[model samples]
Target: MTQLSSNQFIRNLTIQDIDDCIILESKGFPPEQRCSPENCRYRLSVASNICLGLFETTPLGDSKLIGHILATKIATERITEAGMGKRIQGVENSGHFENSRNIGIHSVVIDPEYRGVHLGHIFLTKYIEYIRQLKLADKILIINKESLIPFYSKVGFENLGLTDCRFAGLIDYDMVYNL
Candidate 1:
């Protein structure tokens, strides 16, 4: 697979990315597994600093958001439906917990054309490094399908076993990468 060109790079996402994010999100997740438009905006408004996006610069100098990892700060070790849902305790409608110790990764999406190019792996590694540098959270958590456990494991995430959190009737494994 071809790699991203030199002009492409990863940066924190902005509210302006919501449209691209929504489009890419639909392509990446199942209906029930997808974050709704409201929640996407909430995550960005509350924690845009952790919403990492991989963008490719076009020949005209405009940037296209191709991939993103949307995360939220929470106190829970294991992810809950509420955590992944639009709102959760301590996450006020207007703001998020400033001292949340754990970072819950809600989504990881790449444009359909960008798949199979190792962009997910590269993006994830860079995310971990970026989070670690900030020292904002003690751990980074994610709930993923069994098929992806190995992929996440490759990025130093340890599978803590099956979780009670069910979405789209698929079994999910709770994984974590300690910073």
Candidate 2:
């Protein structure tokens, strides 16, 4: 695995960065987990937070986009009065987000050649930090299966409980991180 120099910087993702992100996702994830181009663009366009491209200046006209991470708003209604997270404090139902105060980590992908460079950590730190700064959402959540729990745990997420996130009978964990 190759390592990048320490001077690299992560910048806000833009529409132009979608292709690179798609390529990285295709390489880093299995087909079942990969998002389609339309979905990716919609997500990138609407996310409250997006961190893409760890890069440095070049002699050429622009910097290169090296990595990407995208987080979208997660909206859930308080269906159960006894539920632990029933009352979401600061969330708004802006139509884009369906219900309460939460953000969903949709995707995190790094260029395959740059995996060992800690770019993933750098990208995640930037995303989480931005939300922290804004004080926007009370919690962050993700839906993933058992096999990816270890990786998500390393980044401060915990298994809050199980969710009915089934795709053709496959189940997923409801992971959360309190911000």
Candidate 3:
């Protein structure tokens, strides 16, 4: 794990992390909203370096993944020209991960037991830092619930109003953070 503190750290997701990530995904979102295991595996195979997990170190030298944020890179032009509405589909379906200038945050989840501790914020901050360090993308985008607009805004994402694509029967808003 990439140490963030004495007891906490963030690191890239690995093949071994898929099961844990799926569990967290199930707990965090409904079935229709969660990415399938195949998709998660595909993401890891393609861009494992960008898929991050936040963990707390145990006294016994073990660690638990308490939160995670996964992303896929997409061409900035596609988003700017085609618009986010047209590309809200699955990243694996888009075939845009190869060479891109923007990152789409597919999911972000924190363990229920770990909420309210700003762990989500901490994970996101560190994720952004990692992105910058790697020069990964020119910007980051996310389609999130309206309730999360302010939260994302606080993280430097600008609201782009409602999105055209609907997933899991919930209305979502598009937000972007330019690097």
lDDT of 2 by residue, 22-76 (tens): 8877887788777668667776676625444566556664666666666556555
Instruction: Please report how far candidate 1 places residue 115 from its true position, in Å.
Output: 1.3
TM-score for model 2? Answer: 0.73
How well does model 1 score by local distance difference test? 0.85
Q: Which has the better lDDT: candidate 2, or candidate 3?
A: 3
Best by lDDT: 1
Cα lDDT of model 1 by residue, 42-100, tens digit: 88988999999999998999998889999888657778766765654566332345588
- Predicted candidate 3 versus true structure: per-residue lDDT over 85-169, tens digit per residue: 1234554336345577788888899989888877787688778888988898888888899899988988788998887657666
Q: Where does candidate 2 stray beyond 4 Å?
A: 1-4, 51-53, 56-62, 77-95, 98-100, 167-169
Candidate with best TM-score: 1
Off by over 4 Å in 3: 1-5, 76-93
Reference-based lDDT, each prediction: 0.85, 0.64, 0.77
**By how many angstroms RMSD does model 1 differ from the true structure?**
2.7
Sorted by TM-score (best first), the order is 1, 3, 2
